[model samples]
Target: MSMFDKTTKMAAVLKGHPKAKEVLESFGLQCSTCSGAKHESIELGATNHGLDVNELLTHLNALFDEPPGK
Candidate 1:
């Protein structure tokens, strides 16, 4: 199962996943540099950004499916 969900904190996601910043950026979320990322959940961020939470989560989780050292 994926480690991230809509309720997962942005900070935790960024910290726990090596490519989280890239994934978030691709979805137009500058979470890595946003102060709110410290406490903001993916759902909240997605809502605020007008992004589909489920789609964002799918892309975020897909980072795990990459081959090692990608």
Candidate 2:
């Protein structure tokens, strides 16, 4: 399973990924718990949040490159 699958909450994605959080917020996603986020996958969220999906995908993949708990 992908790291994304290992977690059930958006907060988990950012727990060890401050850079990724910054990137997300830069796209105006103030909170993963925000209503809009509930209906969007991170990929879709990035698209609708005014982010460049390709860039976000690259960054997010990098964030997960290191094993968790490192």
Candidate 3:
């Protein structure tokens, strides 16, 4: 299983994958402490931020897909 899916919540993703924080930040979503992360889906957040959700999802999933130690 991947670390994140489109429906995955920001909090859950960050909790499960620490490296995800960097990716989220790169996507302009520095919401580590935001309440919305607790319930907002990745897609929703991306949409709200006027970002490309698919690109974000791909980047997020790809980050986890990489072999350990890149």
lDDT of 3: 0.86
For candidate 1, the C-alpha RMSD (Å) to the true structure equals 0.8
Best prediction by lDDT: 1
Which tens-of-lDDT digit does each residue in 6-44 have in candidate 1? 899999999978998999999889988899998899999
Each prediction's number of clashing residue pairs = 0, 0, 0
Model 2 residue 44 lDDT score: 63
What's the true lDDT of residue 1 in model 2?
Answer: 26
Per-residue alpha-carbon lDDT of candidate 2 for residues 1-70, written as tens digits (9 for 90 to 100): 2355322244555654656667567666675557554445666666566776666556666766767765
- Please estimate how well model 1 matches the true structure, expressed as its whole-model Cα lDDT: 0.91
* Top-down TM-score ranking: 1, 3, 2
When summed lDDT is taken over every stretch of 10 residues in candidate 2, the lowest stretch is: 1-10
List the candidate 3 regions with Cα displacement exceeding 4 Å.
Answer: none
State which candidate, 1 or 3, has the greater lDDT: 1
* Top candidate when judged by TM-score against the true structure: 1
